[model samples]
Target chain A: MGEENVMSDDILVIAEHDGSNVVDVTFEMLSAARELAKDSGGKVLAAMAGGAALAGSLGAFDRVYLIDDPAVSNYSPEAFEKAFTHVVRDVDPGLVLTSTSTMGLDLAGGLSVAWPAPLVSYVVGLGREGDDVVATSQIYGGKLLAEVVVDSPHAICALIAGSFSGQPSPEAGSPDVETVSLEGIGPSRTSALAVHEPDSGGVDITAADILVSVGRGIGSKENLEIIEELAEALGAPLAASRPVTDQGWLSKPHQVGKSGKKVKPRAYLAFGISGAPEHLEGMRDSELIIACNTDPDAPIFDVAHYGTTVDLFDLVPELTECIQA
Target chain B: MVLLKQLPDLVEELEPSPDGTDIDREFIKFILNEFDDQALEEALVTKESSGAEVIVVALDEPEVDQVLYTALAKGADRAVKLTGVPAGTWVPTHLRAAILAPFVRELAPDLVLTGVQSAEDLDGQLASLLGGYLDLPHAAVVVGLEVKDSIARVVQELGSGRSVEEQITLPAVLGIQAASQAPRYAPISKIRQAMQAGGLEELEAPAPVDSADIAIAQVRIRRLYAPEKSTHAEMLTGDPGEVATRIAEILRSKGLVKA
Candidate 1:
């Protein structure tokens, strides 16, 4: 009976909270849930998780299952999965979805372990394929897109951020909120000893409004000072390709690429970076792309709207002085 | 101890020939991926610190056995090859279910370590899937690992300069990032022994868990071109002061200058 457990009325979406607050992705996932529920003729449920005051601000859901414990603030897969499993058991949704953030990946992976269900992650598009839900996934470094379906009763999928079009908030936007508490899932094996925030001006370059990206051709670490001066002059954050981060001239947080952050900066200024395909996938969505590299053969010029070929050592100081002037 | 894959003469991005049937030779070359080597180094260090025997596993063409031997020479106690596991014939999800699931069940190692993502695959999803199948705790982008009292302390790299420390129980899986550790060179003596031992345990291919579910529908490469070059160099022809002022004006026009 437990194995064949099924639900027909609701599609559940997990709520992502930022400590005591809610994150934007939670609403994004809800938007996705509402879409799926529309076709399935079901309602959407948002499961709010975290410490006190967390669920209060998260607005409405079909049934807001709240787990307000101090221990739920920091993410622990073991405890969160246990709490989430309990909620999933109670809600019994036909489909479950979460945003494909780092937390989403962890949650979905652990949930797959607990539920033993197939999970489709980083889904780019979702549509109906016959009776099943088909999702498009970018495979082989975005070179190929695959449309896949999990022909199972219970399906778990992770929605890629910035890939899906979100529905506007409901005009009425109020649903019954229920608080569900899990007892005795305690003593998390790991503890968040501390959250050490990096000193990258608080705004991550990958998530910055404006990004000034440097490359290996900057020649030396000292030359980075000129880039920094330009960044300061423009009020832009700094990012780098793998080479700059690998060289230890810039911290890893400022690194943007397939291995790094998927940034969508309003303006991306490339300084001396030879565009690696791996690097372009992460930041091609920038509103404006201006590249500066000495080698005319540098790849960064391909996708750049405006391009400049000049030695960074000579160009940086001049650019900084001009910005100051 | 766990196995990592190295496809001899494989490039990060294979250059397709004009016919699109075979890869171009010029763009293809081989090395133990910088990330996979980092994983191997972590497994070696964990063995040294805990005195647990370490083994290396690689699924590739026969030639890649040398990389496995290189792993042993760098201190892996043994190696296994799930032969016929074609290079590039893997997605992160399927690879874990195929290679790692049975391997984990059979070896039952206290821990399994792998590169966070392979240079060729670059899925960034393998570690979590392997950990999922093992039903074990997993930490990825792990830059640090230490063993004390049979518990593994791992520092996971969460981009944007944040790291989360997780203490996993024994028999957990960890995916090592390239930045996690420096790859160690194989000693000549160990290399000699490993070569003599052959460092290759040819094993039967893993049967697919789903023989025909969700197959790779097709692989289409619309375009493959090297990145184009930049030709617009804003040359400021003047004295240092004049050049600086012109550069400042350019920066201002580019909106790099504020106020």
Candidate 2:
């Protein structure tokens, strides 16, 4: 029954981009799509609006459907939905994948209705099980893994950030780029009035190779100096969980979590940080994770390579001194 | 109006059932979803300013009355409890949307507010799916909102803390991430007063249309298990000085710091 319902051996990934460059999660989705397509005997195809020139660099894609209309220069859900729906109808892909970013969620939500396909968001893993695609995701805030069978032949799913490592294409082969035009689409109900960019002086933690991240356990704003010194001693950037940033001790850019910067640094030193799923979603991919918290049962320990249960007040200063010495 | 859900509190320890399909709920404690609380607060705030009647709607569940009374204490004018679906049934978002769309239509609400995503969301989408089902303009992850002159101006949180301001005409859905202000605390006296007022209205949920498409598209939870810990923390136990020295050594060994 599943084989008879198969539409085509094509995995469509909706690529996301800022006006200038392709967002990193788009490649991550492509990587996941590539992995899933291997078992399904499907070709990985990427659908992107704007940033068409970058398509050539994405050699993993079998084909790139670029919608380069000025209307879509900025993300309007209606334009994106119309363009994506057109591509979905034209390609008739077996599976569609996108990042779980805000724009990705908007598009996938719209397409779920437009394509009338079943959507599974926050997908952490995808696999083929006896002709049915199984999507694994976290529910109840990452407490349990829910393995859902995509009953629809053409299933839509969104991949969470940092869930898959986005490796570049092994070999550079220029993918066939098809420029699609979306014209005469009506205006959407909502219109973007303005974008408020974070201050330019803010730290870009995503680009940092090493991060010393603090959480609510740091106690107060005055204690941040010790963590800052430790970060300086280690020659790494200082990052924080949502609580620290929310408390105004650190800037928003310094936050490491789902709603913040998703960093895959070489080393992550977490102090007083309990591993909420949101925080883990950002920095879990680090090569080495060292966490310190007063609570031994803090979930951060689950992903940490090394852990020390102690007050940050006692440990951080001593740790900074040791690192400096 | 605000849509609320009673969720198993996250702080509670959970274990998968013997069948490995879902968490064993017998020992769990249910609490109102935090985001939904914020949505309810947003509605109450709007009511404070615009005199709009705030109605709180929730699926029938254990401790749902507590949530509704809490909303009532927080200034919702009406509370609704939808019946027919048994507690703990994992109704997919689309089915929930199908069930609520008609009810919301009946209310003819100028604005509908829901949490952007629930902590227990299997699909991580309810507001968007509901918007699609209702064919209403919707925005997600909104941090701030103001309803004025039939136009809703919303501040939406984008990736990396960037935000965009957008205007959507009223009779739209908004998936609220945070309210403009912190949710007001309802005192014990107020909550008790609300419970005594006895204004909770129960409504029979419309039976979901039996569609083959929806049946086939429904998500099935095959297994539920604790995520296997790929890497275990090697606990370093000692005085602060000893632990710090050990951490320094480990950092040096990993080439994160110079020896």
Candidate 3:
């Protein structure tokens, strides 16, 4: 069999889920893949490695390669890799899309080396330029953008979370499902023991209409009280960038960023946050954004509808009073 | 137990070179990648808890020798540098992985650890690529790791603050996201002691991967540039009170606050 020459104009979306439900990034990958498909004249295929029930969530995909193996019920890296690789080899897709998240990173690189395909990660934008795959990746935590043109026909792209329309995939028609034969995928060397879910009943920032967020510029845990008052006055949830959560100034639930929750509140008030690309990826889609930081060049300004150079310390209490008044 | 890499520190201002293909490194200072530092700490923690040899390896780079020496002072058992690449030049991750594979195969290590990612390679490719080259199981964004009797129990972060725990067989690669504790410091005095001993080992570097092998296109950065600001924000001015008043007005106009 001429396996090496079997590459086709099909982009495979590796769908990820949390135990039972398919995560939003799966749809995002499908969305991005659909865009790529139009240019490459390819079919948007999907592969899921969990319970068959999860396949119901992948209706947007035309064909789903389901590896409904119990070993992949959770996120067992080896089993998932083996099953996904089977699809990649079987389909010989021109492109393979995976989210640049925990599960995606675990599989994408291994898949790349095993398949011998060119790999691109941190992908924010992807398009086909004739035979080449052009990817815009956020490097240096979003400080600079790199235009990587992969000359090869087969490429693996790990799209960063929030790179496209996340949930509510446009197409909802039932797709043809093919059960890939997992003949050789034996027990994996990696065993999934447990998943400690994030604490619930915390201020659900994702559901907040208005979000008052803070970041490293808040300086200390004590300074958080000032922002806390602003959030309370506006009756909005208090959110923070990763550093605030990392420093234990706020619990994990209050954090908003790539590694944190993706929030689209009606209003996003960012104070002291310099707007690392990670943080922006989470809150940039807010209906309205207002940012305040001491630095004029902070990337937060690039996305904010309204911005200021006023120190957060000098601005928050006054803002709180004005809101209350 | 871990690989430590030193690269241009992000704290320094990054400017694209005149050619626009890469960042200008001539004026930038270098520091150990933060994630790699965490990996080193995790290894040192593993060493203290279960008793394991921690060997820190890196490709030769400027100030990398000092970075390794500092690791030795902190607690690593040995330091290694693969020689032959141009000093401080940006090495493609594919080539870097390929170059390290031959040597990593030599070690026949039970466990290989590295930071989940460096700023330069956010894809977290090194661990997985090495796993592919060496044919070992791998995990990424691992926040906690505990090894006992050929089994490595790890807690991997899955964004949105959720995490899953897994038990990986030994002879595996792990991309550490953070350490259970902050990386320990190697007081300058101890660092001097490590340097006096001159323990950094130099291994024969393998020839770079064939250009033909790289034809699979290992992602050449065709260009790098500062992100152009597309939409400048309407910058509010005047006193803090004035700015706050404006913010309040906008919030109300957006129907974000109760009238």
Cα displacement (angstroms), candidate 3, residue B33, comes to 2.2
User: What is the DockQ score of candidate 1, to 2 decimals?
Assistant: 0.23
lDDT per residue (tens digit) for residues B14-55 in model 2: 788888877787878999887787788889889988889999
Error of 3 at B136 (Å): 1.1
**Each candidate's TM vs. the true structure?**
0.73, 0.87, 0.89
lDDT of 1 by residue, A252-294 (tens): 7788875567788767888878776557767877877777776
| Model 1 chain B worst lDDT run, 10 consecutive residues | B211-220
User: lDDT winner among the candidates?
Assistant: 3
Model 2: per-residue Cα lDDT at residue B121: 64
Ranking by DockQ: 3, 2, 1
RMSD of candidate 2 to the truth, in angstroms, is 3.7
User: Which pairs clash inside model 2?
Assistant: none
What DockQ does each candidate score versus the true complex, computed on alpha carbons? Answer: 0.23, 0.51, 0.57
Question: Chain A structural similarity (TM-score) per candidate?
Answer: 0.73, 0.82, 0.88
Give the better candidate number (1 or 2) by lDDT: 2
lDDT of 2 by residue, A216-280 (tens): 88878887898889889988889999767655687777888877877899889999888877799
Better of 2 and 3 by DockQ: 3
